[model samples]
Target chain A: MLSCREVTLLLSESLEHPLKLRERMALKIHLAMCDGCHSFEKQMFSLRGVAKQYVNGLADELIKCEDELPPPPL
Target chain B: MKINLEKSTKTTSEFLHDGEVVEDLRRQMLKFATQQLGDFHLAEDAVQDALIGALKNVTSFGGRAALKTWVFAILKNKIADVLRSKQKTVNVSSLQGAGEEDENEDFMSLFDQKGGWNHDDRPSQWCDPEASLSQKDFWIVFEACLDHLPPKQARIFMMREFIELETDEICEAADITINLLFVTLYRARMRLRECMDMNWYQRSQNHAELS
Candidate 1:
């Protein structure tokens, strides 16, 4: 059985790379029994969601930074 | 000569327009595109397309920043279009060398001698995270948490999450091994997760009790 410490590393790696089959099975079994690891995994996902919003907000700020220049000389 | 906007953006600006203010703004737009697309020629092309698009749509491109920002928005799409087309060809990564970064990042404090989670550091289930997503203050707290990360860890986290770079791409770009990338990212995520829980989740609870 994978420890919570080991599972945390695998969980983060799982976001970046596909885990090997043995690693996957071990993580699954550990997660099924461990509440702490499960919640930690959920937090990782929520962090990704918030990151997207952060990037979108940043881009929107850039787009909204238009100045009130006088209308171009006609 | 390719305008060599590749390295000297100001020279490219000098080639196009003389207004110092407009050139400065053009420099800003060019910098943003280059950071996203990673090549000056492509960035210049995108910037040119954006400028032309803005001018054709609104002939009076005379505004101080109005015209430039509109061009920026268009430039973003152009950069994305370029990235989409170039994503496959961009994978010339070097799978070499073990990086020594993050060798000292031990997570032992959070685990007991038997490897179970420490009582104090064990993660608790978050409450109503979906609702928090729409709250502006939550994002403010999230940004503050990101700001609190160590410099190297912060850079890697941003590349992976915000810029959406692959782990292998990050390994190549940062000159680190796959294992080092995983360790660095794991530390970053742990810190960010803990920070959000403490700053946002628990702080909100305290506020709820106080009110």
Candidate 2:
């Protein structure tokens, strides 16, 4: 069984590249049983969703950059 | 190139009325251009050319595409032209693995001895995160997190997500290896997710409230 930490790594990596069959199987099985990792997987999708919207509204966004200069580090 | 100024339409009149919008767009364009060109004067020249080009053809902006999108397309072309003339040079010393050891440790700190999540720092469940997209305040906080991302990670993230470049292309553009790109992206995604949750969904008192 893969650790949740390892699973999270694979989960993020899956966005960038296709996982190996073994890695995919492990992640799928882990996600089925692990609620935390499941939530994480969904969050990844949400992140992409917001990112796409941000790009779609890029003009409005960049314009905001003008009203207030980039904010200080959080 | 000879577009008759006489062919102006209602869109042009409305667009011209919003002089403030054009001014805001110019400032934003300059910011983006300065980041890419690394020279204020050069970036100003490029943005000026693009804006002039855009206004000259403002009539062509008839309801087909967004006004900002139209102006940005011209700006992109002008920036590309300048880049071709000046050549690509990105000073990413921060990205060249200067503090990778610290970064690895920071990420690993989220997990435990057996690789389980830490009790205090486990990922929080974000409810109906998609719905946040429709809220105007959401963009404000989200942009805060984006600006807060570590500079190195921010660069790669922007290259991939904002600039919309592929992994291999990013590696070549940043003059980094594939391994480095993957690690950087992983860190960027993880941190960004956590930051958004903390600042928006979690809404801790100390963090900026999404008003």
Whole-model Cα lDDT per candidate?
0.64, 0.66
Q: What is the TM-score of each candidate against the true structure?
A: 0.61, 0.73
Cα lDDT tens digits for candidate 2, A25-55: 9998988987888878888877776665554
- Tens digits of per-residue lDDT for model 1 on A1-74? 78899999889989997899999999999999988988888878877866655443332221111111111110
The residue pairs found clashing in candidate 1 are none
> For model 2, how does the per-residue alpha-carbon lDDT over B1-211 read when each residue is reduced to its tens digit?
8877775454743674477867777887787667554568877988889878876776735542366666666776675555444334444453466236336545777889889888877665675333323355566777778767766677677666655566776676566788777778788888888878777667644546532
**lDDT for residue B185 in candidate 1, whole number 0-100:** 82
Best candidate per lDDT, number?
2
Could you give the CAPRI-style class of model 1?
acceptable
Please report, as a residue range, the 10-residue window in candidate 1 chain A with the lowest summed lDDT. Answer: A62-71
Q: Which parts of model 2 are misplaced by more than 4 Å?
A: A58-74, B1-18, B33-65, B73-95, B98-104, B128-134, B204-211
TM-score of 2: 0.73
Candidate 1 TM-score over all chains jointly: 0.61
